[model samples]
Target: MTTELRNQEITIQPEDSEVVLSVERISKKFCRNLRRSLLYGVQDIATELSGGKRTSAKLRSQEFWALKDVSFQLRRGEAVGLVGSNGAGKSTLLRIISGLINPDTGSVKIRGRLAPLIALGAGFNPILTGRENIYANMSILGLSTKEIKAKFEEVVDFAEIWEAIDAPVQNYSSGMAARLGFACAVHTEPDIFLIDEVLSVGDVKFKMKCHRRLAKLRENGTAFVLVSHNSHSILNICNTAIYLAKGQLITVGETEAVVRKYEEDLCLSGMEKATGPLILPKKSPDESFGLDITLVCFKDAQGNILETPMSGEPANLCVECFAHKYIDNANLGVVVKSLSGENDRVLYFTSASDNEFLKISPGNTELQIQMPYCCLIPGAYTAKIYIKSGVCSFDVVESFRFTVQADKTISRCLFYQPRTWKVISK
Candidate 1:
């Protein structure tokens, strides 16, 4: 098969001066070592050099490409988010840009000083005091001792570790270490910043402060490339985004659009129903009395329940149940989960069985429910419908999945709440 980027030459033109960084057809390859022990590396090399017939079993290695011909450019003052599942080369790309490692085939053009917060406290000395470690990190990032001293108080306050600054860095908590690293990097006046999932380290207020500082830097023409799995964080901060899957670029566009697509993919993956019934296996005919859940469905408005819907669209959900024996009052409920299996948001839930028709005697019966539009965000969500016949809650349906998509052209996620905005002359 022809290479995806074979026709495109990997080069950055001088006329594109506004672009601060250009990644040109970059690719990274790593050998997945079947044996990770210390002796394996030396033994493998020796065997290869001895001219012995190399069998596949003896080699026990495969060339794993962590990034495949990825190319993108960031102009001055642009903030872009790099999104992907774990091991999708987000960190590898960041390291390549930060000059920590070299790509196998492609080139990177970076204009000015790059401060990379790729791994928090990666360069810090654990045995040293936090103050000394701060100085060391600042020096590594190309700051003079006098400059660090001048900005010392500002950094300390910004990190909110004024008390711990004098203590050994080894004694600091993980969050404190991250804050110190981030604080030092932000003060380095980097023209291009490479951040990898460090914002989730600190407290909410500190994160807000970091955002403000980054905003100011952005206004001053600083370009930032961020990598995170949190779509909400990306939607709130980044203008553009790139989604990577299995070390290849899948989608790259405005942040909101890429986030929506990523979420939709996740939801579709989980939409397949479980094998047996809607209830768990433990409560099936093996253990519990002769009570069964027949069918469960997620619906949209107009009496049509689709498995997935785009964000801001009207939708409906329904659950059908059947009882083998006489059943009394029952409580029905539903829960929603994010694409990563974290509880996303509850669409609708009810425990009151006011209507007696819900109390089925036997055979088949259908219970329908409706949810209006604009409730859930543009991401993958799962619905866990439950019907409690006895004292405890029994699964009517366990984590039925659905996806919500959004328009790619518009940057609307959190701000898409149903509210009118009026603009007047200030």
Candidate 2:
């Protein structure tokens, strides 16, 4: 990689200028059942009605740790990515930082006014018109009437909702509401910002505007804690990244390194789960069509099963498919699923031109497929590999299963080519 390509310089401001946000050993626990407490209440009432005072009744419940001993600090002008699998405490951490939820332990120290975009339409009145909702949201975001009035046009323009500015928010689509909420949040002149994947909404143009606004704020020493599964966004913008799992921060480092680690952890966990001997599904002999997979692995540059690789290195995927018949013209493909099961991002598909089509003459054939590194982000992603010969195209398939990790050290940025930035100071 050229110096210009590999070395994407980020301006590092002084770290001692009063840490904008300090999250120290914070943890959050939740009770699973409210009905248990209700039952205890009824039991206590029955005991008291018998003319005998009862001691405190135990509340049957199940405990869940959403966060545990997670610590990090954000100096002014710093941006950090909070990433994790679903139920990995990414949202919980954001909620705690936004003060929407209190932590069970430790503390969050935040300085200056904060703008949180954790939830779309969190403060908006659904029944109110878009104009009224904007006003209400701005007020809740600490904007004065005069300030809202002054920036009203800019907000509408940024949100690209000039035509629907007067419509009720309830009538707006989810994207429209998200755009409005994002507009209101950015309008507030805040020293700290907490965002949770709100940029995934709206169109590309709106997303660009949001990125520009974030860049402007970041240049002004406004710290940000962004919770997102989109590694590209985090890598392109954030100075640091933290990966959380099971309510604990598993990794933290420079944006590039941290993203790579997060992807690695995801792959490792999935592999362990898939490789455990007891994961085999029970089979009933009555079922005629039964298929199983074994020895799923990714290949390095030299066509070897690769467990890990430095960023920017070459890699490929190798999986052996076992079929029970002479399947011809099978469409071999792989679908990469996120850990959260939100959506499966297609990694690769080959019908006959993958140059990898194999004809099984009533026997099992080892099929190896290769994919370049540019197609994936540096994160843990699961894969579903299959061979389909009929219109069904799913004769031998694994949906919502399998896992593969991308190697990113080969690139300067996280997954894609690094973008250029020009710094201008008056």
Candidate 3:
């Protein structure tokens, strides 16, 4: 069944469509002070016992909203990524949906069984062996002993802990425990899965294995709600994404749009300390030098400004600057680097000097760097601009950020290159 969310209202395409999960006007609150919180909790319980209305709208001492009127739906075979900063109510929302926590207002309707892998080693008993914990956890998940026994080998195989299945779980490494938990959750074969950053616990090989298993489950009509800080994984797995901030739902739509909006918010929120690269001195163009970068944009092949570009598509990086002074031999450079701020992250770097030095007169000037086809990999990237006159640095701006989505055919390398493969007599 097709599912759509507009203005917090969930609509299924077909009249008889099956929705695996539905959240309506869900909200949660918390109090900062422990003593006051306990008192408020007791008061709320008393009010409930007396059949009186609970005061959820009004805030008491040190009370604040953890989630504010959030609503969404998930259908079978659908995957949604939750994106936000710390304390953005993502985890709280997931907990509410998983039935681990109740909302202060509104309700959640889940039609089928759900498996939540929220915290690592959450349900496992430290004193129990890995194998014994598997059975115990599955039983707690509402599975019968026979059912757990039947799936025991499958879980062990998936977790790849056969050598240590008999060992106590307290001795297992974090990754091992995470694998066991994930294996148990997936092997239960629930209709809906709620995951919160657990896929990042294991090694690369195991993570990929888990991703593949999740894809297979989706093919079998399982729905997923994934919360992760890794935007790449969100783009890779989820078709839709929801962005949250300060306990409020900011936007929910296509995955790329939501992720791009989240990144923009991060940049505006001053979350990333280091800006993009600076080829020259860090000085305002209008102060020390005589150039001011007014606008920076990325445009598609059709000349339409693009917020997100597709990999292998023709695009242009446009930089507009206002020059207060004239210069004879001024050089303009543009560098594209990964947003992680790690060494060796510069994907592409070039300068006007590579072709010929740019000679700009005084006043406003626009520079367009044309790419026949953008070959950069599919990920977040930042474009840094620099202008220099001979040995003196003029201006620099390093705030421009953009994301690239991979084409239909998966290209995993740093950049795509034109080449043909030929076999001469194997």
User: Where in model 3 is the C-alpha error above 4 Å?
Assistant: 1-17, 270-380, 383-426
Clashing pairs in 3: none
Best by lDDT: 3
lDDT of 1 by residue, 1-426 (tens): 111222232233424878878998788776676455345557646876897643322223466678888989899999999987788899999988777776766777766677998887889898999899888999999889999999999988888888888899999898889888888999998988998988777788888888999999999999999887777778777889998887899999988778777766655553355222233233455654545556666566666656455556666566676566666676677777666423446456575644532565675566666556646666666677777765655445666666565553333444236556899997
Q: lDDT (0-100) at residue 145 of candidate 2?
A: 95
* Candidate 3 C-alpha RMSD relative to the actual structure: 7.8
lDDT tens digits by residue: candidate 3, 1-426 = 243433233333423257788787888899999999999999989998999998887777899999999988788899999998889999999888766777888777665667898986799999999989998888877689999989999999999999999999999999999999999999988888899988878899998899899999999999999998877678778879999998899999988778766765665465342222212332354465677676677776676777666776787877777777777777778777665213235554556547667767777777778887777665566677787866788777765666666655433254666456898996
lDDT of 2 by residue, 1-426 (tens): 011111111112224556877787887776577886567558758986898774422223575678888989898899999888789999888887776766656777666778998887778888889899888889888788999999999888877788988888888898888888898898796888999988787788878888998999888889899888777677777899998989878889898777766765665663545421112232333442433344466667676666543334465555554555566666666676654324546355775656656676544455666545434544555566666665555334354343334432532333444346899999
Q: What ranking emerges by lDDT with the best candidate at the front?
A: 3, 1, 2
Clashing residue pairs in all predictions, respectively, total: 5, 10, 0
Q: lDDT (0-100) at residue 394 of candidate 3? A: 75
Candidate 1's C-alpha runs over 4 A off are 1-15, 34-61, 270-290, 340-348, 353-358, 406-411, 415-426
